[model samples]
Target: MVADAPLRLSDTNACVDAVIERVGKNITLGLPLGLGKPVRFVNALYQRAKDDPSINLHIVTALSLLAPRGSSSLEKRFMGPFAERLYGRIPELAYARDVSANRLPDNVKVSEFFFKAGSFLNNVDQQRNYVCTNYTHAVRDLMALGVNVIGQMIAPGDGSGQVSLSSNPDLSLDLLPLMREREAEGTPVAVIGELNENLPFMGQHAAIAETSFDVLLEHQPSDYPLFSAPQMAVSPADHLIGFYASTLLRDGGTLQVGIGSLGAALVHSTIMRHKQNDDWNAVFDRLRVADRFPVATEDGGTEPFREGLYGCSEMMVDGFYYLLDAGVLTRVVYDHAGLQTLINQGDISQQVSLDTLDVLRREKLIDSPMRARDVRWLTRFGIFRDTVEFKGGRLRVGEQSLDADLDNADSREAIRTLALGDRLTGGVVMHGGFYVGPESFYQALRDLSDEDRQRICMTSVNYINHLYDHAFGTQRLKAAQRVHSRFINSAMMYTLSGAAVSDGLDDGRVVSGVGGQYNFVAMAHELPDARSILTLRSTRQSGGEAVSNIVFSYGHCTIPRHLRDIVVTEYGIADLRGQPDEQVYLRLIRIADSRFQQDLLKQAQKAGKVAPDFTLPADWCNNTPDAVRQAVTRTGDEELFPAFPFGRDFTDEELTLGKALQTLKAATSTRRGKLVTLWQALREKDEDGRYAALLQRMGLENPRGLKARLDRRLVIHGLRKLDTPSDTGSKET
Candidate 1:
């Protein structure tokens, strides 16, 4: 009798064991880290290695272990008062702050940090939870480090005795080389996930087979925690910043946004502009900026935005969701299944349109009598306003509307208004490989009808890298064109004079894998109508000092100066792409936090990148710490402005700890020995609990000083900030 099938699907734990066994002597092991099997499985392996003395395990995933080398919004949230409470109770331990600094423990080490270099440093690690970039590099590095075991998921039946590293493809085509080498060396043991059965089959290298992996894990698709970006209070500071960027966005401009706090803030601000019927677009027209939005291109379609704007980009994050609600992403012209199908697929690919208004009306940008039922149902998905009305086959709402029957002149003007209104509402594509946090927002989106849900894309299954590319691409090209501009408030957008951007530097080491920035930036330059904007704080605290992020040079640049398009701070915008050395230096100097502007200018002058006669703009020079504080203040109290504009996903204690941590950091930076004294004064019981809490904030990690050390090193490189000895001995450390 024929033997039973040799390749039965393995149970989750059995799959994990088989992969681990296959990894028996592989030198490197890489997997995505987050809430899913990717993270759980990888962590399990690490724990196993911790127990097995023979196993020399090294992980290349993006976890708290690989956080940036400086204060992160996430870290600050955890380290603040939590540190104070724990260290306060044990004053003697406060001096141990440096114990967690740069030097890795003898047992664990990440030898090489890999990442795609780009302007925004867009990558998997920076987003809520991205497995592709994180997993790819981690695996690659493990092999390079002479790691004996490398474990990752693949489709069953895709393996040919040899394992295949397959899934969604990243912008970095070079990963194929690493895979080939691994397979050629007979080192790769593919661990496949059968979760793709229900996923849409994307085209190209994204396709994979069950046979490619050496071991197949037949468990149900991981149940990812649905995280929602908070609906933040849109402060005037955020509004003005978003407004300025919006002005740069022409009706058809393409865009790319990073993820996180500022991203949500920007989206909220944009939605407000739509609600208030702002005249922001007029500003862009008046400026006569380069790469103006195209009403119609060779693609032979008039962008509805010819009357206004549209957006296209990769992040299917909150920004994308907001765009859909506001109505900026209406489909004027579509190829296969029309707008609805494209929306459901969670993507759009097209060029500008000439007669966009007429075409869109014919195609249903306005409600047709035939589709009135669908339109009414749209309201359930939060797609329509209470004021929506149909007159002569056109959609009318509030003061503005879209009418197909108006004369050429009336239609032109009406179309502009309609486009603007829609631009305000639509153009967001949200996707995350792993989402962790509050699920309300996601549930809100998922609650929408298939057509409305089609407007949002949740990339549940794909390769670690390709998912990012799809997310980033959709964000830049699709979301930007529809929405005017987009925002990414995630992390680490390094600016070199040209051609590179790096993320996370610590004592000459890279902490995480290169994610999607390279793809986003390259795509940005290609999209004349679009821009890739990078956001970063002005400074970070290390040891007991504040370090400036606007440095003359980074020891390693995640995104080079050439690729540097636009960098923003609380101060202002620094447009650096395609600029001369002098221009770049001058522009960057203008936006550096006020306290360091003069120093930066001096350094620029010393380097001869700026002329001695180059004077700071009077308006730009007005920026000061107090001025920034005032800038963010609105009609309410200062404390009302949340560090995260949307909403805080953390607990009340966590928020308090974040605030306290910010205060402590400020104290540590300004006063020598204060970090230690502060630690002593604030230390409390449950020190381990505090550490654990911080770790959970970082997605459930054990307390370790590696991330903290990297932060300090980056501070030293970026702003020359260093920790004082006494501060290094903090009890929390």
Candidate 2:
């Protein structure tokens, strides 16, 4: 491999062959999570390992996305066309598919720090192999495993000797240092990049010289479409959860949101608060948000954003785009520590006024007579015009050179007149590690102007996930940029003791890896004004039973009781940051579903965690599913809570059918529920023309067999149930 240029290979097999020759048969491959995995090269390498049993391949990564496959026949029929149509030419990850099906070759062992949410619930292999670590420690863990080969899908630059890590620079940027160290030690190591034309070429820290890679797989076959995640329907419960969480956000603050419908809901609510304050206030008032939970009014706000928000998240979710479109995510933080600190302190504005340079001088950041280095630094940060030149203790503009000394009044005037720019450039509105979403998200990034694209920096996870960054960003800079921060994420359950269960079940089945939730939660405690918020539905349908997510105790805890902060459900918000155990129990129960509150309270009382004499308040007792539905529907505003806040990939028919299928699946999850659903389907009337389009879509219009007829009847029953209004979280048919 050349120092100035990568060993470019157009063929996938050639790249794999080069890697094998360099790293021998025993290869420890480290691929980036999600969309950045170099599919072609990895497939070829894995194939080689399979064919030659002597080769041992250990692949380590997270969220290796495979196209969705439905288990039942009807689900397959519904999802088949949708998946094929959306992800037709996209290269499927053969490793993920094999690993999922438990058919991995004995020689190839795969490990992941994070699984796609709920992907491997019953797989003992995945559960046993799951690496428990934060997102910040992924690089460290990979190095400890002696990873020698790194693979990624890169975006091409403008014919320069550069490329953007594009969707994922997360671990690759962090691992570069270690890879370099191995190379210096003469240890065989490889960095392979497969170029994709569809990948959005993001700049900032994501851009690096092509020499970073030792092997390049660049051609048509390898440059397939990137894997995309379609938008899921945001339930009424999710919207309510988002609405409650939105009130906890300060106007001028920092935000860290995860990827999913819940995060999207929060962004939508925030947008509504900013754009349609009247509608937002109506919902807030109707829900008695201020009256019940004064923490919202005391710590958070309900008014429009005057200072806006700066997004500092691990994943650059599509919701940020909606917020950006609404002019709500406009708070930009600079790269320089002093400049960002001044902006945060209100000592200087982004507009390149004379105060910008004056503040820098006052902070002892620059000399009275600016040195050549100071001139370069000012121009680099957009404080000065590029046309202004500093040489020999003077400021040069075209032909005229004036005194550069700020102490001289005449020189100051001359410098301000010639060197000032309109506003600050190089300030980033969002700092993210990686992203995966619907086609619109990728297209949105592709369609952005170069100037606009730079506003959302796709950098290493070390930068956005925590404030302990020594490379990409410093603790001081992150602290200064983040003010009154709200770190929002989703959890599956919460205990009365204030512990949060997010990643896995008590049975030792891995649902998803603890990627950055722990990092943000710990950081929230460290930051003076920041709060970590975990959101979940109050009640969820599990095995056809309405189970309470707020439990008395849980075996697995992602966020322990000591680190508990804010938790939001459809009913209300529970601030458990500094509260006692009994107070935590009371607050959690008040926000739980009305049906389960009694049992939860009884359990708490029996365990001596809460007062047995304490009875539920009448106002809090109405925290039911119907109450949440009535609250949203009574507003008479459709735009207040939408299923798809940003644009959706699903069509109207698909949306209708998908929702009905979900209700059917939830209703019939257990034997008793299935029997009841079967009885309902047998009595369902099919003479109506209302479901003609839906029947045609599901291929149940003209059934030729008994199974087909039964499926048709089930479809009709589901469609009929869809017309009836129920709680968003209710799975009952």
Q: What is the C-alpha RMSD of each candidate to the true structure, in Å?
A: 13.6, 2.0
- How close is every model to the real structure, measured as TM-score? 0.56, 0.96
lDDT tens readout by residue for model 2, 1-733: 3367888888888998899888899899999989899898999999888899999999999999988879886788788878888888887888889998999999999999999988888787888888999999999999999999999999988888899998898888889878889878888898998888899999988999998988878895547877889988787888899999999999889999999889988988999999999999999998889988999998899989988999998898988888887899989988877788888888988778877778899999888788999888888888888888888888888897988788888887887888878888888889889999888888988999877788988888988887887886688888888889999999999999999999989987889989999999999999879999999988877786789999989999999889998999999999988898899999999999999999999999999988879899888888877777767678887656777778788888888888788878988999988999999999876785889988888888898899888888898888888887663445421
Local lDDT at 645 for model 1: 48
Model 2 CA deviation exceeding 4 Å by range: 679-690, 702-706, 723-733
TM-score of structure candidate 2: 0.96
Q: After superposition, how far is residue 254 of candidate 1 from its true place, in Å?
A: 3.4
lDDT of each: 0.43, 0.88
